[model samples]
Target: MIKEVGIIGLGNVGKVLATFLKANGMLYWAVSRSAADDENILRNISDIKELPSLIIIAVADKYISAVSEKLAHKFGKELEGVFVFHLSGALSRNELILCENNGAIIASAHPFQTFFVTGNYENVFVDVLEGISWGIDCKAEYFPEIEKFINKLLGKAKYLSSETLAKKAIYHASAVAVSNYLTAAITLAKKMANLADIEAEDFLLPIIKTTIKNNFSDVDFPITGPIARCDLAVVKEHLENLSVKPHLQKSYAFFGAALLELIKDEKIMSEEQIKQLEAILLQKHLY
Candidate 1:
């Protein structure tokens, strides 16, 4: 039933959301300091108080609190039934107190997708990543209408209770770690490929695509690298090479420990082999 929307913060996330909303035939008003960049959205309002029925704040986390408060104060009287939602992955609905206090229905609708600055949209997210959405810290009865609307209109949205938003935070973080951190790891792999006298991109095609393919079907253990084979010698050599990049070394060791633990559950790695990797990981201060 919520048709008209006002979207703030026209960054990557905001821009993508706007594109989807417009293509879906929703009457939308997008706002930003550089609103002139895109002249084709439904409408670009300069004032937050003049926002439509639904105000989607896609601003930075630091700005979400202050900006939501200012908007609430400005539209306190007029927000009788308007819905004000933010697109933050980490913030809960309690942070949206300003809107809730002003009688505006508030929640968080986070689409689990990446932003490609390049111009392309088809199959960008597909089944490789899923959308996980949750609401603010408020009673379900207070915003059941919005919850139902989200389920009907948006991507596969799952409801998390207000009090359970913290648990939902972990869920959201895991999604980001899988998507964002995977990209970082691949970038490192490409760099290592270049350093090893192989064309970085030449050998990346199947491995990259196949990894995504595997993830789409199931959560299979990574089977290519040393960790997959529990190759202690190769893993130790990797640790020695990674000593120069201390932060990356720690990250690799920490995640490697978790992955090592996972594979051992399936009896892929013996207890002795798992401890061997854990010992190397501890040397990197990642215990």
Candidate 2:
């Protein structure tokens, strides 16, 4: 039932949010500090005449507090009864305490998806919001309204307790580990593939896709590699081969150690084998 929204940033996430809201026939006023050619975007927060029912401070984490304070200074107590939130996964509703103090219903809602403004706005599908999970940390009293708003976007609302900082931090850390770290791993893989004169995409794409599919479909033990099989010899050979690129070798070792920690409890390998593999991965020369 939320009809109007105010977005205070125009970066990748902000642009996608604006596009999605506009596509869904919701009235939105987007504000950006930087000069933009778009007629719909306002260049200053002071230019906003009327505050929307829902205001999303989509700025970077470093600016969330400052922007919240700015809104409080600009609109004052007019923010009362308004739903104000940010798109930060790591930060809790505390970042908007200024607005909250002014009686705004504050929350932090992070969509569990990577966003990139690649091309035309028309090509930016609003359907990307469909079926994705949103990490929402807010007061219990405000949760139902937020849940309804997410439901409207066809996203599941995962309530993260605002009382616990560790939970929110861990939630965001897990997101970074999966999304950002996965990208880094793939980049490394592509680089290694290119070094061997193979078309990186042609060789890595299909397997990467399959591995991800298997990872989701087979949750019990989706890992498959020399590490999974406890093939220390193969791992050692890989390290030896990667020695020419010490940076890549260090990355591989770090990832291998982390992976070993992940599967250690699965009992895929004996303790002695695990120790040996750990020793190989932790060898000072790799660092």
Candidate 3:
């Protein structure tokens, strides 16, 4: 029974997670070394010695190693038998192996979802975690509580073992791709739109919204614009016009190549079409 859910960092992620946990009638405790006193009640406590059953550290990666080092001292102390966890996507469960050595069960319960302070984000976890992946690497005891917390709150948990680290890395990278790279791609597209003399960013709202809806709903089949239509003429013009953004030409070419490959794999484009797109891309010589 996770009566008290303790957080070590009180950023947007920590705050939102604590909110969800507390809303479920669980005790919320947190500690932040650099936080202001007026930030949140659960924050401001800098030491984690007293420790709760499930202690979540949402700090920077550099500090996580140090944090685990500090927790390592508590081995055979009061903090023994605690369930230690974090929210980092790239780091492994071994970074906190010291905590495990100290008799603290260690795992990572990263929500495969984005964090936003406002907007309709509470429901973002609604269907997102139906078959969504989570992570953990500890003895058998901690999993049932973690799964219970995940299932009862808003999502599901997929346990991770040492053998599944590669899949977990890929999964976390995919989440980053969806959030980080999607934003980058959209920013690039917005620059392209700006080239079309579409100045106001608000003008992109409906397009952005529809594109995201398509992404969440369509998956691999979500293709639009000239590439999906096999309009090489438009692609040629795009390559020609991309001279204004010399650094972006290679990226555009890469995306076009990937897009073509996807289309061909779907049987939407013929071999000749692929050749034409490839030749035009080669002519640009964005390499």
Best by TM-score: 2
List per-prediction Cα lDDT, in the order shown: 0.69, 0.86, 0.72
State the lDDT at 42 in candidate 1.
32
Which residue segments of model 1 deviate by more than 4 Å? Answer: 23-27, 34-49, 120-154, 161-164, 215-225, 237-258, 261-268, 281-287
> Tens digit of lDDT per residue, candidate 3, span 14-128?
7667656766666456677666674344433344446778778888777887888766764445557777888887787777888877777788777777665465535544444
Winner of 2 and 3 under lDDT: 2
Residue 141 accuracy (lDDT) in model 2? 76
Model 2 per-residue lDDT tens digits across residues 186-286: 99899789777899999999999998898889487788888888888999999889988899999989999988887787767788878989999999887
Ranking the candidates on TM-score from highest down gives: 2, 3, 1
lDDT (tens digit, per residue) of candidate 1 on 181-287: 88778877776676567987779877888888887776655566888777789988886787777766676677777677678787787788778778887673644
Off by over 4 Å in 2: 161-166
Model 3 clashing residue pairs (backbone): none
Instruction: Tell me which residue pairs clash in candidate 2.
Output: none
